[model samples]
Target: MKASNGTTQDVGGRRKNSKREDESGRLGEYGQDSSVNGTKQIGATSADSSGENIIRTSVTWDGRSDAGKILEEVLLLKQQFLDYVKSHQGRLEARLDESKKQEQKFLANAEGLELRLRKALTIQQTKDESDNTEEPE
Candidate 1:
């Protein structure tokens, strides 16, 4: 690793005398690209290639004009989904309350009808008994 001043600089215990060569044998830094189709590959080396270790990394996209707009659109979509779920849950709760009220009303009406039927049956039975007693026996 020779510097332009014709001297070798000790950098991180590695002697760098010439221009740094990338994995593709192209001269560039970590994030720089020497061509349009090739990428600066940054991934697991041979030390951690198997399933024994976990490597954590994050990807940084090259700057584009519509990145913010795309992110905003995604957030808006998530909000819309949340809004729909909230409205639907409210309507469902209303329906549940209405159904409960209707069931209670139906039960009340049935109880009233049963009481009236019991009273009518008692009166009819008493009249029949009186008519039989007033007969010859």
Candidate 2:
């Protein structure tokens, strides 16, 4: 490889003079052009491309403003909060239904006991009347 100047530095750090030519015969930088195929090129890393959708949206919507970034974060947090609320609401509703069923069962049991007590009272009254009517020995 050669340096920016026309000096070709060898593998052993020995400098040799040579003609500098770019990949496309340009006399300056030895790489691809700033644009390719008549369109601007963007070299995004793996980490950058991972969130490319978010970055594009942010740039398009707000032109790289701080408030725009904050808005995106807030939206994500709001979605998480909504998801949590939905999950907790489902669990709460199930528990409430269970409690209602238990209360109904207790109420039905109380009503059944009340009916039995009334029946016992009627039987005792009939027995007392018969005993009073009987003659003494």
Candidate 3:
């Protein structure tokens, strides 16, 4: 049996390893160098999260193997994603504030218009009553 390098040979010198690559880095024994590989894998999820696979990898603080380097890249990507989410949240809050301001202004204008209309109606009614009370010649 060949190693898990995704390669296999047959009797006729033919490669018969037809399998899709597992992106989860499932290269058999991974905890062989936990002490010397000062690394960690951190992941968080939410209620609406999908995908049961654990997003994990080994991160090397000082010096590690190729797998450690790959894990480091993953950590960097996670940080970048968090930064992007924070930035988006800030923008959304700003937009919400602007919308509230606009709504308040519209309500104030509407109230002023309503007051003016009520005053005009009251004046018109007073004029009509005075005309009816005047004595005719």
Candidate 4:
């Protein structure tokens, strides 16, 4: 079987009898032997030939496996999401500040208009009073 890391392993659960030339002319016992039963095959034959099959059903990961890479990608995405949120928060704060400044300016303008209207009303009232107190020719 080929792992994600491009390493080849014998997953056929066979025992190698002797070193033979494979179809690719490789002088290694890495080929699967049909004579050996998958259920009965153990680890590389020991010197004692105990006829015991040491089947490793699990793979040991050293942080370079596919799952590790996926975890790293997830963490990177999380950081990116946090950064996006922070950036949006800064923009929102700036917009809020700008809105507050505009509101203050508007309020100041309204107050100035109100003062001008009050002064005009007072001048009109004084002019009417002086006209009423004058003698008619």
**Number of clashing residue pairs in every model?**
5, 0, 0, 2
Q: For all the candidates, what are their Cα RMSDs to the real structure?
A: 21.3, 18.8, 17.9, 21.8
In order of TM-score, best first, we have 1, 4, 3, 2
Q: Which candidate leads the pack in TM-score?
A: 1
CA lDDT scores, all candidates in order: 0.79, 0.81, 0.75, 0.79
How would you encode candidate 3's per-residue C-alpha lDDT over 1-137 as one tens digit per residue? Answer: 44456886543544588675655567545433333356643335364345555444223344545777788999999999999999999999999999999999999999999999999999999999899889585
Pairs with steric clashes in candidate 3:
none
CA-RMSD of model 3: 17.9
How well is each residue in 1-137 modelled by candidate 1, as lDDT tens digits? 54757787765654667664576656436764345457545457674366543433223455655788879999999999999999999999999999999999999999999999999999999999999999994
Q: How much is the lDDT of residue 100 in candidate 1?
A: 100
Against the hidden true structure, what lDDT does model 2 obtain? 0.81
What lDDT, from 0 to 1, does candidate 1 have? 0.79
**Residue ranges of candidate 2 with Cα displaced over 4 Å:** 1-67
Clashing pairs in 4: 42-53, 42-54
Model 4 over residues 9-114: C-alpha lDDT tens digits? 7576665776545755555456464345555454555753655453442355555579977789999999999999999999999999999999999999999999
Off by over 4 Å in 3: 1-65, 135-137
Error of 2 at 6 (Å): 98
Candidate 4, residue 38: Cα displacement in angstroms equals: 27
